[model samples]
Target: MTRFDAATADGRRELFADAIRAHDERDSAFLTIEAAGNGANAGNDAGSGSESTPWVQFADGTLNLDCTDDELDRLKSLLDEFPSFTVDDLTTPEDVDGTNVRVVARTDDERVGEFVDRVFQRVYNRPDGYRAWVTVV
Candidate 1:
């Protein structure tokens, strides 16, 4: 996990910006994060279509998406739709396989959690190193 202080906005911006830039040069990139707490149902019942449980807490830091070309494109689409995120392409050329975009977080931590939960879901009792294993739902 690339260490970025998720507690601060500047850190998040730098992390996202750097990730976007790094994605330009590499075939894959993943932000690694440490586990912070137990994954518990946050009052949202099963089949509700909305999960209250957070796979990676703010305190748990952030994990890398380990994105592929297609996944990065899909992520860009998701970021475009998400109000709290922006796909910045001013500094970089268009991505070869995807759009050259930087997914910057424009909102607070709580909202970031909500956005991530939309893409990655947590499985209880499954640990990946110090973190609970997360999968696309």
Candidate 2:
């Protein structure tokens, strides 16, 4: 678990930004905070027939799929102005196989590490501290 303490807002913001950047690099995707309905969902198709086969589909939820590195850094800085920051108690596995990984970002240290692990699992199928069949991804 990585640990870091922030005594001021600026320090917290910087730490948060650094954490976000690290996460982006590991995940190969950027993070952004956009409006709820301004994003597109990558849907999955369940049939090879025509559009009248009652294809089962579902919304994958909204996300900022096109966030720039600088944008993500800015958001991290903004988030630091809240209260405290820490990124500890994070675990990363060595292998992943397409499963749901849970990211628990409580303090600055834990949040950053967990966020990075989760994003990496989501985008690049990487594993964090402990590998599991259900949360490997």
lDDT of 1 by residue, 42-104 (tens): 222222234222232221223333333564656656666676666443233355332233345
Q: What lDDT tens digits, residue by residue, belong to model 2 across residues 1-137? A: 04232323344334444545554455634332111111121122212224211110001111122223443344345335423333222223346322222222344434443333333233332222212111100
lDDT of each: 0.38, 0.29
Model 1 CA lDDT for position 128: 26
User: What is candidate 1's CA lDDT for residue 75?
Assistant: 67
Error of 1 at 113 (Å): 0.7
Which 10 residues in a row give candidate 2 its minimum summed lDDT?
53-62
Against the correct fold, how does model 2 do in TM-score?
0.21
Q: Which stretches of candidate 2 lie over 4 Å from their true place?
A: 1-3, 28-137
